[model samples]
Target: MKLRLWPDALFGRLALILVIGMFGGQLLTSTIWFETHDHRTLEIPSRIFASRLADTLRLMQDAPDDAARRELAAQLGDDHYTLRWIDGPGVAKAPSVAQRTVENLLGDVLARRLHRQAPLHLMDAELIDDSGRHRGIFSLFDSRMPSGDFHVQVQTPGGAWLDVTGQEGQAGRQSEPRALVIEYLLRIYAIRFVAALLFALVAVRIAVQPLRRLAVAAEALGKNVYRPSLELSGPREVRVAAQSFNAMQQQLIRSIEERTRLLASISHDLRSPLTRLRLRTEMLSDAASRERLSADLDEMDAMVHTTLDFVQGVEITEPRHQIDIDSMLGGLCDDLAETGAKVALEGHAGAPVSGYPRNLKRCLQNLLDNAIRHGGSASVRVQDERESVSIIISDEGPGIEGKDMLERVFEPYFRAQPGKTHGSGLGLTIAKSIAMAHGGTLVLRNRPARGLDAVLSLPRG
Candidate 1:
């Protein structure tokens, strides 16, 4: 058989979509975050360092000489200081505290040269002394030209005020911003990946629950098992699916009932003609021919009755009432024994089962009669299965032939043993019908050492 590739329930498809959506959302979010924030990650740190380094260079502009500039540079390049200028045109020296290892050798050497310069000197100068503290200032200017003249203000140590300015060294170099930005983006996406996986699993479970229930109900229905109609709940689509299942079940039951009613009506209508024929056969004059006609009519009558009984079995309308199968079977065995048939009860008894007592009794009676008629002695055994009940009736007689063992007995008017004038072969058929009517089954099998065994199984309430 060819199998369809799509899922058959709303929840299953929902779960698939949820998983796909979660994964897609995670991917999209990470992609956008990487695209937008990649450059910002490295630029933030670089901008902070650049601003502080610019302030330190301005401070060094008013220093008295190279030694004072060196002291200031050492102070600015301390472990706690994040600002350090690179070498440019005039002076050159390694920065004292190198927190970040610069990948470009030229940028590091340039920064060292700029730090050694005695600030950028210019011709315009202003002398300002604030208390006894020495202060220095320089104009903010573009770094492309090192000869630009700028104003300067300063206060010397030992309460002296002085101002001197001049043009200084060459402009500094910049490192590539790509690597740090990429690393930061990768870290962000890794965190989102773990979160997305957990969210996807939860989404899958919630979405698939309805589909699981539908699967269980469908399986039971396929097996001809009785299960309650599903509740119409969950998402709108899932509720619609449940409604469709309910409608389909109703249609199936309706079709079965209609077919059974039609068969029953046919059986009932045929009975009148069958009775007349039986009466008419009795009126024949030739004895042997009359007897043969009577037998044929009897068989026809039995067939009609069996057909009606089977049809009734198809309609399961009766509410299940608890019935003591053990007591019922025991009483039936005693009744048969009293009637001079060899029958007995054999096995441990269990609790009562939920079923139609009349149907149960009828099933036992049919089996016992068949056993006694063909197999001589019959024994009824009752036992309990976990959630159900079972009754086995074995008889001691010549066992059925292996070739005819499986399908012979259940068919109407099919008697395996010949030359025995008895009722039409409707006994096992009736028994099977009664068993089915009560939500159970009847099966016939040959006993290993002796005769035939009839097994009846009933579901528990």
Candidate 2:
């Protein structure tokens, strides 16, 4: 099995890239926020707690005796801060990792304010609710659960330990770790992911629309050279491409027109001289010489006519429309039957094809004629499909003598049976050209049962 981390389409791939990039940015931002927020949460409370402890210690040191110090400590205690005197060390159990961190920060602050060091031990330091239940300090950051408690014992100069407790609260209702985590996921990850996805889709779609239109225009050009020019209504690059394509189409049209005019001139100039030559041959004294000369002139005339017809078929500018292929094939078979040609038609085209009707008919007629002349009989079959349609014409006589001749037979003036001089040898050449003009293909192959098959495949769209 293979894993595909990337998508194939432009829109999908672009959207994936955008979403991943946004998520990475959000993660970095959250990490920075956590660091700064944690420091602020610890700093402000530590400073206030240290200042009050310094004042209490100084006042206790000035008292007359132990009883007086005890009475003074009890009077100075309040709701947010409390103090108690013990005869021995107050904290016995070891502090946790989080408690140790809090202990060191407060210890340093208190020593600086009092201008002296005292032996200090942290008893407890953790997040808590109003009911005084301990909460994990390593849980997700939430503004709701802002209250916390800090307890520590510090040894005074008189050899007695002073137990100190400080409680702090922020302005919000308390919440649990599970609820905080869910809130953080929804706010930070889910919202950003959905926003990035929508943005990427809209931006990528707008960017790729021009490219899609350009591709469709290029395809239409192949089927019809005279297709309407592309509309220049996109970004600068897209407009430039459309302009270039239109210029190329115009150049092609001009070149074809020039070639057609030249062929027309040549046809006129050559026929008059050939007619004069035929008249001169008819004036010959010997019947054998006259017959031979006339036959040669006739062959020359046939060659000229066939050559012009082939070129005209290729350069035809017929407009495209829906063609009933089955009806056309049936009609051709009936006409050939009346002329004593052994032609058979089978199968129907399930749908109409979009193409030049006259050119397609000419292409099919040429294939049928070639098959009947060489194979003595022709069988036509139509295979309709979703994307394309196929017309297969099979003949039943000795097929092409060699495999190489199958392709060579479509070349102009190249005959498969070299000894036979009946054909002008441009039939298959014209048929192939017509197929290409409609963005279709015409292929010839030899049959296993001693015949030839010409398959013409035309695209549905």
Candidate 3:
């Protein structure tokens, strides 16, 4: 398996970026601080050693003879350093490369303290452990029990040599390098990492909240174009987006209103000519020709009305409210049964659904009318579910002849039984539109046994 170092979510990615940045910054800062601290640790001890050696040399120069000088050296001696009169130089040859560097550092400090350069020889300068064995100079600051041993010889005014042995004590051993590192990791890195993570999560959450709200509003717009506009409260970008969406909705509403008026005008104009034609047909003397023309006129009028209804169903202007599915279905069935049409309803809708009640009823009424007209009977089965509700209206007639006709029936002016004289062929088209307006679906399928089943499914929310 391959490793996935990057996260998918915006919050996760932001948090990871912040945490890594903080860790890198802390590492860089700690590195610089450790370097500076190490240099100071070495410099402070060197200065102290130099000052003490300078004072000792001054005392030895004032001594009367060898015995007095030896007595004075013993008096100046302490746990940190020991001084003695030597017959020859303490270090026979010159100091090595590492020792030379340290000797020069000490010599410069001693000269400044004494106000003149002193003839000095460095024999050994090294870090040591408790066993008195030498350790590498690089481990001086990091070592747990760090100590220093120094051997030096200085020439007096009389050309005699004085040997000094100095030792660094274990006063600062409690603050070990390992303990310092652990403290730095906890106090600096760990604390900051957690703080960065929380900050990133909260910041990203707040920033993305507006986007989530906008998405929800866009989805709802399809169901109801006149739903309340989004509240403009957030960053500038979010506010701008909300304003644009509201403008778009207003534009859609205006366009739909214009189309409705245009259709209404055309219907009115067509009806006036149709009315005149019907009046002129009434004056015809031949009875057979009059009846045929009257029937044609009636069909044309019905087609005009059905076409208008189809267009109106495409965009329902009514506001949504709670609808009792059971009550509505029962009423439609009762009305049809009263007219001697076979209609039956089975199953109950446990809860009311939110939708345009008139449009929903019209959709159901059209499906029932089609079933009764073609199949001689209609049976509706309501299936209520968690997210949506399904109303299955079945008929006992011979189902659509061809598989293609099942879908083609939903198209405007496309009738399954083309020779039928009653319908304007826009009933199924209008019903499908109403179903879509309520964020639902209307589909027709052939029953396993016989007849066609029209299933209308509407979302609960």
- Which pairs of residues collide in model 2? none
- What is the C-alpha lDDT profile of model 3 across 77-104, one tens digit per residue? 8877887778987435665555666688
> lDDT of all predictions, in order shown?
0.59, 0.79, 0.81
Best by lDDT: 3
TM-score of 2: 0.66
lDDT of 1 by residue, 301-415 (tens): 7777776775564344555588987778778878887888887787754677877676667778878888888778888887788787888888887767865555677876677
RMSD of 3: 8.3
Once fitted onto the true fold, the runs of candidate 2 whose alpha carbons sit more than 4 angstroms away are 1-198, 274-304, 401-405
Which lDDT tens digits does candidate 2 get at residues 305-394? 776787788765777799999889999999999999988787888899998998899999999998898888899999989888999999
Candidate 1 has its poorest 10 consecutive residues by lDDT at 137-146
lDDT of 1 at 45: 31
**Ranking of predictions according to TM-score:** 2, 3, 1
RMSD of each: 14.1, 8.8, 8.3
The TM-score that candidate 1 achieves is 0.57
